[model samples]
Target: MTVKDSCIVEAGTLLVGVGPDGAMERRYDVGIRVHEGLIAQVGAIEAVAYGNDHLPRYGSRGMIAMPGLVNGHHHFGLTPLMMGVPFAPLELWLPRFRAMRQIGNRLDTLYSAIEMLESGTTTVHHIQSGLTGTPDNWHAITSDILGAYDEIGMRAGYSFMMRDQNILAYEDDAKVLAALPEKVRDWLAPKLGAAATPTADYMDFFRAIRSGWAETSPDGVRVNLAPANLHWCSDESLQLMSQTAREAGASIHMHLVETERQAEYALKKFGHTAVQHLQKLECLGPEVTLGHGNWMTPEDLDIIAGCGCTMCHNASSGLRLGSGIAPVNEMRARQIPVALGIDQSNLADDRDMTLEMKLVWALHRETGLFNDRPDAAAVLQMATEHGAKSAGFGGLVGRVEPGLKADIVLMDEKAMARPFVSKRTPVEETVLHRGGRHAIDKVFVGGRLVVDGGKVISIDREAVMAEVAARLEAPETAAEAADWEMVNAMMPHLEAFHRDHPLVGERRPYRFNRITP
Candidate 1:
């Protein structure tokens, strides 16, 4: 089948971008014209001229046109909860993920991509790491991931997760290994047989990916660096990643203080907060985005804001894992750009950015009335503009304007605007309060229709799901079964270790309510 350079037009109530005074502007009966995958014109329908008179037109009525959602931080397309990995702190949960069986890479990626697109997510920052394989193995896996996104027609930023030390605990791996029982230790030997690949090798693989797969497109995929987390990566690894990203003109994303335990680890290991350590390494900049800043202090916020770095708030992930609420309001107060992400752990256990946005909107309203909180517009920006910027697509595909990539979502206005009353509710407010996958009428990326009629258009959803289901039903390998047993035995011991070795410094207030005697 030959792909043609086509033109398309979409007309609806257009929620545009920030105005000169920094307020969101909305216009009714506006039309956007897409030519060769880029937005050509945005204005009154009558004023806009299309190069092709027979081009397709969509969302003529009862629809709202807005920028496509961007998932600022995500992992593989699959969710751990679906595979029997329950909610635990991020540190403990990491091991559980290892025990889960691996399905085909392409199928797993498409599974999440379809869900994301149906929920109006056109772009994602996928943090990939810790896969057990040689460079060739990694190449094949990364190729499969990128291929899936290419077929599904979604933009993605692929960041290879980098870590070198402390694979099991905040302290030395020897200590953690010594603490395990003999049976558990033997079972884990095969899984943890090799030391981490040399940092130079990781850099070489990254260069290979950058040259081969990181092609330039208005709404295509790019590769970035991810230093996994503070406790996982050594200082040398972090420095190498920072320098490589800087030299390559790519972005970096890392987890910082996702939980109180991680905060404690930072103080215990580095003599400072995680954010301060990043600052000390000179890693904070416009191109760096710190994921899950739940335990960031006011001083940390100042440093983040001062450095022009961004933060991604994974609201449902925090709640699901019992991580503390991210201080999004405080970050915004400090003029730090805060974006939204699902982090593969939304309340629904699916990739739904609309629901994630609503959760973010509701999660940070702790202050009394009259205190500034995230309104609908603010949350919308986090899901769209700020999110796009966080994924390294700044000013590229997040707004409905000429010269931007035509990555847009058309929502069913009728579904969102149901139960009509005398006073008309604003479209943005209605979307934030009521919108979900059911309300998504269509999604377009780079002027190509990727989803329509509440279904993804480019791939066979049913076939993908069926294949994955069949693969998952097959019996696990002996290694996998052994790892599962090891995880079960390790959980209690790991929990006890954390409980007994609490932070030495003054601890912060409890993130959630504790049962009192």
Candidate 2:
């Protein structure tokens, strides 16, 4: 229909990342029709557009309408896990991760959801991990987390922590055997179970659980599986996770070349980069999303793009752990899809994506995030459509328009982002570089309000914080506390290991999981 035939819901400005070409348009007097939560009508001032006649209309007011952002890769359990910690590099950080309390239950997950929504991230690809305490426990932990997301009215793609080999990132035998009074080992023995159970059993159990969750709500949760992470998973385990996700019709999220050490191992053991090996294994495709793909060779990036896979970059975690920035600009130049993630910030302590995106600007020159400085709009897209696409929505999300999920955020312009009245200024500049969470007035998903006025509409934030505090105080009781203590206490041993086992000098069959003919 032409503009004359349409009813416009004229807001101050309408930002539409329309079409696969990503043509962005700003129009006034735009009307939208919300039929079953999708924008059924879009046109100029005379046209009627989204939402119900009974609901609040955009009217002539100046609201910068834009698509909601997506967080393509994450580990929700890290919040409580990061309550308090000593700072260290990745090799040292992994050890600390072993002992952090699994304080993130349904409520904590909801709290994290609140923070993301407040920041305008409506969709999240939750790459959960460190959940293996006992049988059915893993399912319980993940399901509880997703339940919070559903109740909070956020859209999420849930990838489970599928580690066939390491149920828990257990301490090495030397460390455990030395410190574990036989009493502690015996106490944990029954829970550990026999070591020889087929890995498929774990896969089957989680798949059944995923199917059940999908059958139940299906809207809020996208349950997929992947190995716990590269360092934490074996080659067979990675292939099995990939195969399982394929059979289950679910997406995958795995850590690839996250650190210098991990990259070093792939070269030494596998005779190729981890990404190259996985590519050889036929695992790089739309069905897979690689989280924290740092240290990739030019060839590795090409393979990822050729397969139409996504590289979910975690900017916060990289800086905190001293891992180099992802070559985002290289991927963009090659037309590879890139998405944003928070990574282990709950412990390492950076959850805000606004800061994360800016980091792209600060270090892009070094990492080749862009040949020229990336424009604000480009960085915003990485946080939104690029992120949504990585989560498998492609063009269906990360934008405000017809035929897309109405994952949206309304910014309180009256707050910090002042003088937004100019018709010439781009909204991307305001949202990406200026507006902060305090400016978030409302957040929506599928046309549903999840967070309003910077507060969660569903859960009690105060109560959630209380539970988090309680869990944080007693990280010692849980297995996580023990693990962190063990890892840190043995820093000397790990340091010694690092001297010989430098992260740079490694590549083994397990590390380089390729399906040889």
Candidate 3:
């Protein structure tokens, strides 16, 4: 099948951008002309295709056209919860992740891609969690994942998470292992050895992936660096990641202060906060994107703002994992760019950016009548423009404007106006308050129709789901059983390590509660 070179996208109402007065700038009955995957012109439908009436068209007079959503910080396709890991605090949940059965890379990635596309997410920053194997194994699995995205036609920013310490807990590996029983320790020590890949290999892996993607899908896919977390990475790893990212002109998305204990770990280990230590290593900068900053202090915020780093807020993940609320309001007040992510743990256990947007809008409201909080427009920005920045796409996407990639979402205006929505209500508010995957009529990435009639057109969704079900239904393999046993054996020791670790520092309260004044 031959692909078209140009097409006309018609919208009943198009979200141009935020206006000077802080309202959504929408144009009625607009048309966008996309050629060679980039928007060539945006104006009246007749005007855009006046001379060339032969161009294929998408959307209609009943759909709302907006920039495709971005998931700034996502881990994997099959969620941990779906794999039988129940929700727990971040510290406790980390250990249980070891028990998750491995689903094939392509199938798992395609599963999440469909979910995201159905929910209007056209781009994602995929921060890969740990994968143990040789460099060749890493390359093969990474390729399979990226190939899935290519098949689904979704833009992606891929980063392999880098860590050389504290693979299972904030405490040192030796200390945690020492605290375990002899039987458990003997079995676990060999397993940990296989998981340890040299830090230099991580750098080489990034370079190899970057070079490969540059030739294949340079604009549609980006390769970046991710130093897993403060407690999980050494000073040398952070510095090397920072320097490598700068030299390569790539983005670095690292997990930082996701929980109160992580913040405390920094203070006890380095006599400073995590953000301060990042500064000390010269890792805090514009090219850096920090995931979760849920436990950041005012000083940390100030430093982050000065360094011009982006923060990807995983609203649902924080609530589900019991990692307290991020200082988004404070970050906004400091004029720092904020992005939204599902973190493979949205409230619905699905990758729906619309629902995630609603959560962000409602979760940060202060108690007082006049207290500042996220508005519909602000939350929309986080899912689009800000998210693009966090994912290293920057100005290439996140706006429905000419000179940008034609990644757009067509919302069913009829569904949005279901029963009755006042014409006075802004499209931003309507989308933020009421929109869901059901409202996503269609999705287009790079001027290609990837989803039509609320279904993916690029691949067979039903077939993929069936394959996944088949794999999941089978009995556990010997390797998987052993891994589960190791996880079960280590859980108590990990819990005790976290509970009794020496990093007991003062944690600032952030979650809403009944007690006040």
Best-fitting candidate, measured by TM-score? Answer: 3
Q: Write the per-residue lDDT of candidate 1 for residues 426-497, one digit (tens) a residue.
A: 677887888888889888888888889999988888898888888888888888788788799988887777
Per lDDT, the best of the predicted structures is 3
Point out the worst 10-residue segment of candidate 2 by lDDT. 1-10
lDDT string, candidate 3, 116-150, tens digits: 99999999998888657888899898999898998
**What local lDDT does model 1 show for residue 33?**
81
lDDT value, candidate 3, whole model: 0.87
lDDT winner between candidates 1 and 3: 3
**Could you give the candidate ranking by lDDT, starting with the highest?**
3, 1, 2
Considering TM-score, which of the candidate structures 2 and 3 is the better prediction for this target? 3
**lDDT value, residue 286 of candidate 2:** 82
By the lDDT metric, which is better: model 2 or model 3? 3
lDDT of 3 at 440: 89
State each candidate's clash count. Answer: 0, 29, 0
| Model 3 spans with C-alpha error above 4 angstroms | 1-5, 19-21, 505-517
How much does each candidate deviate from the true structure in C-alpha RMSD?
Answer: 2.9, 6.2, 2.2
Q: 175-201 in candidate 2: lDDT tens per residue?
A: 433444454455444444543345577
